[model samples]
Target: MRDMKRIGNDRVTSIGLGTWGIGGKEFPDYSHDREAIEALRYGIELGINLIDTAEFYGAGHSEELVGEAIKPFDRDELFIVSKIWPTHFGYDSAIKAAKASAKRLGTYIDLYLLHWPGDSFEKIKQTLHALEDLVDEGIIRYIGVSNFDLELLRRSQEVMRRYEIVVNQVKYSLMDRTPEETGLLEYMKKEGMTLMAYTPLEKGILARNKCLEEIGKKYGKTAAQVALNYLIWEDNVVAIPKAIRKEHVKENAGAMGWRLSKEDRERARLCV
Candidate 1:
C-alpha cells in the first residue's frame, strides 16, 4: 500500500476495494458470504487498506461482511467508508442510519457519504446538513456525495463548507468518460476533493479490449491493470476495482507505483 493522503483529518488509500459486487445481491450473481469474506481478506493482504461499502448493499449485510474481513487487522491501518441511502434524508434518519451502518461495520466509519441525491433538492440539502452534524458529533470523520454531477457538486460544496467534504464517489472508468465530459473531474481537482472511481474496470469490459491487451503486453501488465493504471495516474483520482479472485486482487493492486508514459496515456485515453 502507498502512503495515505489527508482527507480532512482522516487518511485514505489511493487505491481501495469496492465491496459492492461481493456484498450486494444486485450484481451478476449473489455470492456467498464466505467467498466475499475471502475476497475482502485477500484484498487486505494485498495491501489494500481502504474499503468502500454501502448500507443498502444487501440491506447492511455488506457492512457485516466487511467488518468480519478486517477484524484481524489494526483498525488504524484501514480506512472504512460507508453510505446512507437517500430515503434516510432528514437529520433523524441520517443519524439513525449512520449509527446502524457503523454498528454493522464494527467500527467508526472513517467517511460517510450520501448515496444519492434523493427525490427533491430540499431533501438533499437537509440530508447534507444532517451529515455535517454527524461530523461535529464525532460519528463520521468526513462527508461526501456520490453520483452527483457538476451542478450538484457545486451546490453540495456550498453546504459542505461547514463540515469540509473531502471526496466524491462516482462511476468512472476507461469505458465511461462522463466525468471528464461533465467537468466533474476538473471541478473536484479545483476544490481539492478526491474523486473515488467505483466501477473502475467497467465491470471487466476494459479487461477484454484488444487495444488494452496489446498495450498491456508491452509493459508486462494485464489489460485490466492497464485500465486501472490510467485512472490512478490522474491527480486526486483513486480507483476501487472489485475483484472476487485472489489473483485478480493481486493484479488490481499492481496498478500502483509505475505510471504510463504520456504518449501511452493519451493513446489509452483515446481508446477508452
Candidate 2:
C-alpha cells in the first residue's frame, strides 16, 4: 500500500473513490448495480480506504449501495465520506439528514460534509452547529464542506465550535487549475485543511492526453495515472476520481506510491 494521506487524525488513500454515478445521479438507476457494488468492493480490497459519496447522489440510493458494499469489510479500516444536500441544511434537517445517511450506510460517516455553500449563511451556521451535535452523538467523526470557495470556507470555519473543517472537496485537475489560480488551494494548505480534488481527470480528457502520455511513458504509467499523480503531488491535496470499471480502479490506485520529479511535475502543470 502507498503512504496514505492524513485527514485530521485518520489516514486516507491518496487516491480515494468517488461515487457520483455508481448507483445513479440525481435519480436512481439500477442498470449496473451489481457491477457498481463489485467495483466498490474491488477498490476497497485494492487498498483504497476513502469513499466519498453524497445524499443527493442517486437520491439517497448511493448511500444504500454503499451500505451494502461494505457489509463484508471491517468498517473501522475504511474512511467513509458523505455529504448532506442543501435542502437538509439547518439545525433540525441537518441532524435528520445525518441520521438518515448513517442509517443508510449502516455505520457512522467518517467525514460528513455540507454538499455546498447553499443559499443562506444563517442556514450554514445552523447546519454546522447541528454537525457538532452529530459529532457528540456519534453520528459523524469529522466535519467538512464541498464546492466551497475561500470566503465560504472562512465563514464556515467561524461558525464551527467543536470540530475543525477538515476538507474542501472541489473540482481540481491539471486540465482545470482554477483552485490554484484563485489561491483556494494555498489557503486550505495554510489552514491545515485537505483540498479534495474532484474530477481530477477532467472527465476523462486526461485519460488519453498526449502530454501526460508522454510523461507516463518515462514512468511506465498511463495518462490517467500521470494526471492523478500530479493532483496529489501536493502534500495537502488528495484526488478522488470516480471509476466504475475494475481496470480503471486498479489504474487509479497506481497513481500513488511513487513521486514525480520536480521537472516532470512542472511539465505536467503545463500539460493543459
Candidate 3:
C-alpha cells in the first residue's frame, strides 16, 4: 500500500489520483478514454486508494470513467471524492447535485466537497448544510470544501451543525505555497483537517523543476516524487496530481513509502 493519511477518521492514500483532465477538462473528451481507464486501473494496481473527481471536471464524464474503471475493485477499499459545482450552491440544488454525482460514480461518494466558494455566504452555508444532509442520507460519508481561503474556511466550519469539515482541497505545490504562506495550512493542521494538495506538480511543470530534480538525485527519486513527498511530509496533507498517462500514474504512485530529510524538505522552498 502507498503511504496513508487521516481525514477525520477516514484514511486515504497520501498520493491520491486527481481526474481533472482524464475524460476532459471542461467538456467531454473521449479521445483517450481507454488510456484514461487503463491509467486509473494501473494506479489502483499500484495501491492508490483515494481518487478525487468532481462534477465540473470533464462535465461529469470523469466520474463516469472512474465508475467504469473501479468496477472490479472492492468499493469499501477505495476512497472516492467528488465535488458539487457552484451552479448547485443552493440547499436543494446541492443535494440534487450530490445525488447526480453519486449516480455518475455508480457508488456513494466517500467524500463530497463544495467545488468552490459560493457567490454568497448564505449560499455557502446552505451548501454546507446540504452536504451534512447527504451524510445523514448516507449518500456521502464525509464533508469538505475546495478553494476556500482561511477566513471563509472558518465561517464554513461554523455553518456545519452536525459533522466537521474534514478537508480543504486547494492548489498547493512546491511552486505554489499560498496555503502555507497564508497560515491556512497551519490552522488546518491545528484543527485536524486535511489539506488536500491539488496541482501538486504545477500542471506537470514541477516534474521538470530544476531544484526538485537536483534534490531528488540524492534520493534516487524523480522531481515529481520529491515534490509530492514534500507535501505529504506534513502528515495531514495529501498531494493529488492528475495524470492519465500510465507512466505518470506509476511515477506518482512511487512518491510515497519513503521520507525526505528535514533539511532537504526545507531546501524545496527555494524551488526554481
Candidate 4:
C-alpha cells in the first residue's frame, strides 16, 4: 500500500482515487464507463485504497461506479468516502441522502461529508447532528465537510464538540495555494484534521508545467508525479487526482514511495 494518513482512527492511503470525472454525464468527455471501472480497479491493485465520491456527482452515478469497481476487492481494506449535497442540509434530508449514498456505494461509508456549507449556522449544526446520528447507527464511521473556508470549518467544529471532523475536501494543488494563504492548512495541521486535496493537479495543468518537469527529471518521474508528491509530502495532507485511463492510474501510483528534495520542493512552490 502507499503511505497512509490517519483520519481519526482510520488509516487511509495518502493518495486516493477521485471519481468526479467518472460520474458519467457530468463530465461527458472523460466518462468512458468501462475504462473508468478499469482505472479504479487498477488504482486499487497499485495500493491506492482510498476512494472518494459524492451523491452530487452525476446524481450518484460516481458512487455506483465505485461500488462496481470495488466489488472484487476486500471491502475492509478500502476506505470509502461520499458526501451529501448542500440542498440536503437539514436533519431528515441529510439522513436520507446519507442512506441513499450508502446504498449506491454498496457499503458502509468510512467517511461522509456535507458537500458544502449551509445558508445558516443552525442548518449546519442540524446537519452535523444528523451525521453524528448516522455514525451511531453504523451507517457512517466518520463525518466531515467540504469546500469550507476557515470560518466555516471552525463553526462546524464548534457545533460538534463531541465529535471530530475527519477531513475537509477542497480544491488544493500546486497551482492553487489558497489553503496555505488562508491559514487553513496550519489550523488543520494543529488540529490533526486531514486535508484531502481534491484537485492536486489543477485539472491537468500542473502535470505539464516546465518547472515540475525539471524537478521530475532529477527523480526520473513525470511532472504529474512530482506535483502529486509535493501535495502529499506533509503528514496532514492527502491528494486525490481523478484518472479514468489505465496508464494514468499507473502514473498516479508512481507519485508515491518517493520524496521531493527540499530545494526542488521549494522550487515547485516558487515557480508556481
For model 2, the superposed segments whose C-alpha errors exceed 4 Å read 26-28
Candidates 3 and 4, the one with greater lDDT: 3
Q: Write the per-residue lDDT of candidate 3 for residues 127-228, one digit (tens) a residue.
A: 889888889999999999999999999999887899999999999988889999999999999999999999999887889888899999999999999999
lDDT head-to-head 2 vs 4, winner: 2
Error of 1 at 11 (Å): 3.7
Q: List the residue pairs that clash in candidate 2.
A: none
lDDT of 4 by residue, 44-118 (tens): 999999999999887788898899999999999999999888888899999999999999988999999888886
The better candidate by TM-score, 1 or 2, is 2
Candidate 2 per-residue lDDT, tens place, 1-272, comes to 66588999998999998999778762255888888889899999999898998998888888888899999999999999999999889999999999999998999999999998889999999999999999999999999999998888998899888789999999999988989999999999999999999999988999989998999999999999999999888999999899888999999999989988999999988888
What C-alpha lDDT values do all the predictions have? 0.83, 0.91, 0.91, 0.89
**What does candidate 1's lDDT look like per residue over 47-74, in tens digits?**
7888999998888888998999999999
Provide the lDDT at 118 for model 2: 88
> Candidate 3 has which clashing residue pairs, if any?
none
- Taking all chains together, the TM-score of candidate 1 against the true structure is 0.94
| Candidate 4 residue runs with Cα over 4 Å from true position | 26-31
Task: Give TM per candidate.
Answer: 0.94, 0.98, 0.97, 0.96
